[model samples]
Target: MTTETMQADDYFYEFFDAVSNSTDISYVQKGDVLLCEKTEVNQFGARVLPTFYCINFILSLIGNGLVLCIIYKYEKLSTVTNIFLLNLVISDLLFAFSLPFWAVYHHSEWIFGSALCKLVGSLYSIGFNSSVLFLTLMTFDRYLAVVHAITATRSRKTMYAFASSAVIWFISILASVKDMVLFDVQPGNQSMMLCEMTGYHHNIMKKWQLIGHYQQFLLFFTVPLAMVLYCYIRISIRIMSTRMREKCRAVKLIFIIVLIFCVCWTPYNVVILLQAIEMSNGDQKQCSDTLDYALYMSRNFAYLYCCISPVFYTFLGKKFQTHFLKLLAKRIPCLNITIVTPTQSSKTTSFRTPNTVTEH
Candidate 1:
């Protein structure tokens, strides 16, 4: 083995941290080969990542599942915006499905076999890419629905939404094919067999890796983020000018979702982009402990988007909150709550004697 090999593993994990092989085994560079010196695991990562994954797994699964149920239960919830949100939930679920494997891997090593490795890696990429795409699309959808209502009303349809979702999912899955093909199970620091990228010819592996990093940064981060900001800016300006109370509320909700998305993902993308560029120098230079720790933390924040999104949806959408309460009331007979739907001139929604009405 060589330092180059270790560097390759680090880069792979930088982009997709949860199940990527850990750099536990320490080594030193010799004249031409690298000799394994000791098995020094990252204690911080070992302690932090598993717990983070477990919590995210529980919250995302429950929250996203409830979101799906609410959407399915109410016809009013299936608008163009909510349709995009539905797919967003589905993508987040895809991300969550991979977390248990990641949780286990963080506590120990990659106990899963080669096929599972490729499957999990591909799923992670698919989920992440599709989720961003959906969010970006949601921003555009909101911009049109708010800014150009007439045109948007004519074009937004259930069939069209499903068609767009299919295209995004197709592209996302296609982007993940490289991960499925390149990653394989290999011997790790100890007796551990780890799953990581291998089999690239030396002449082109560097170029290939660089290209992959650039693709991820562009497709997953830069382009979508830029579009989101631009759309939301225009949306904010348009909504501010309008005196519609509902639109004002909608603006607040959109702001929360977009802000959370950026806060969660931006740092992780930046760190990965910097790391990819630095590693491309082929010097086998290791990153500082500070940068390494930051990467670990940033990746966790990025994963938290899955859990955080449903929380925002629940809190922001009055209809969603009402349905959620009704659903909750069903299980707990003592919570006989009543919900009143909003009327055009109703200034405020009110609950009846046997029920409670909640406003957003």
Candidate 2:
């Protein structure tokens, strides 16, 4: 804090000096407050990392944004299932909003202030949690329709669907806000603080961090996964015994959505579970490079689900697909790439066709 200490610490200047001094490639390691060792490497690969991050961010942004724009543009796409799809798109779009800033953070220092940090980080958690929750809900809807045909239709009304979604999002918000509150920049470290839960209170941080991660697995992964498996198992049984072709369509959609959900989240959850096991086993050291890389890959690749979710809707849901084709026609005449609908929605009503059944 004193002038002497300030003069003694010159990491910023040293960093630039080392970068400028090396003709080919250089690296700097801070050994102490004033002593920094600079080595000229074959190549300084730090810049390439940020570039990759930026690329991923751009791709995810365009994908998620397009899904949202298309969903909102068309009227026929607005059904109950599409409503859920809309909510999912909104969450992904919001998450994409933070990716550019994250790309910047990956390359450089945290130029954004404390408030934006909190906002962005919280939004990230909220969006991911929301996505997971909705996937779970969608699976359950399928279970209800395919397994418990008569009950599903009467229970899944428009108002109740909206209410359920609202409640799920509110819970997600509550679950995610802790990450923002706990996050803090590592003292005296320039940039390079990635997203993780910080415990403000001694043991509190670790306890809460572990809880949040596992909670994600439980609510979003374990329970929902169980329900999905059960739904499909039962649906398969019914289909085989009863000889119903229409039954196949509902289960098919459900299966695709479930597969998509698992694909999107399995890697990320695996990484988290690994960390949890390590911590629980008393390995308090920094993560191994391989583990860190796995986590990074999981987080980065998870965004693919954003674009994928809507596409599945189009593929499985006849009503939304119907509207989507109409919009494509309109789009051609205008010579504009105007988007049509956000959802690939199903048109099945509460009432079932004589021998056929539809799931949520």
Best-performing candidate as measured by lDDT: 1
lDDT of every model, 2 decimals? 0.70, 0.59
Q: Can you give the lDDT of residue 19 in candidate 1?
A: 53
Q: How many backbone clashes does candidate 1 have?
A: 2
Per-residue lDDT of candidate 1, residues 139-246 (tens digit): 677667656868887898878788999999998998888888987777766676666666654435556667777887898889988988887778778767866566
lDDT of 1 at 38: 25
C-alpha-based local distance difference test score of model 2 = 0.59
Q: Measured by TM-score, how close is model 1 to the native structure?
A: 0.82
Off by over 4 Å in 2: 1-73, 76-78, 186-203, 241-256, 284-287, 334-360
TM-score of each: 0.82, 0.71
Q: Which residue pairs collide, candidate 2?
A: 70-341, 70-342, 71-341, 71-342, 145-359, 199-205, 313-344, 314-344
Per-residue accuracy of model 2 over 71-177 as CA lDDT, tens digit each:
67754333456667667767766666676666676555556766777888888778777876776566566556666769877887778669878988998888877
- Please give the range of 10 consecutive residues that has the lowest summed lDDT in model 1: 350-359
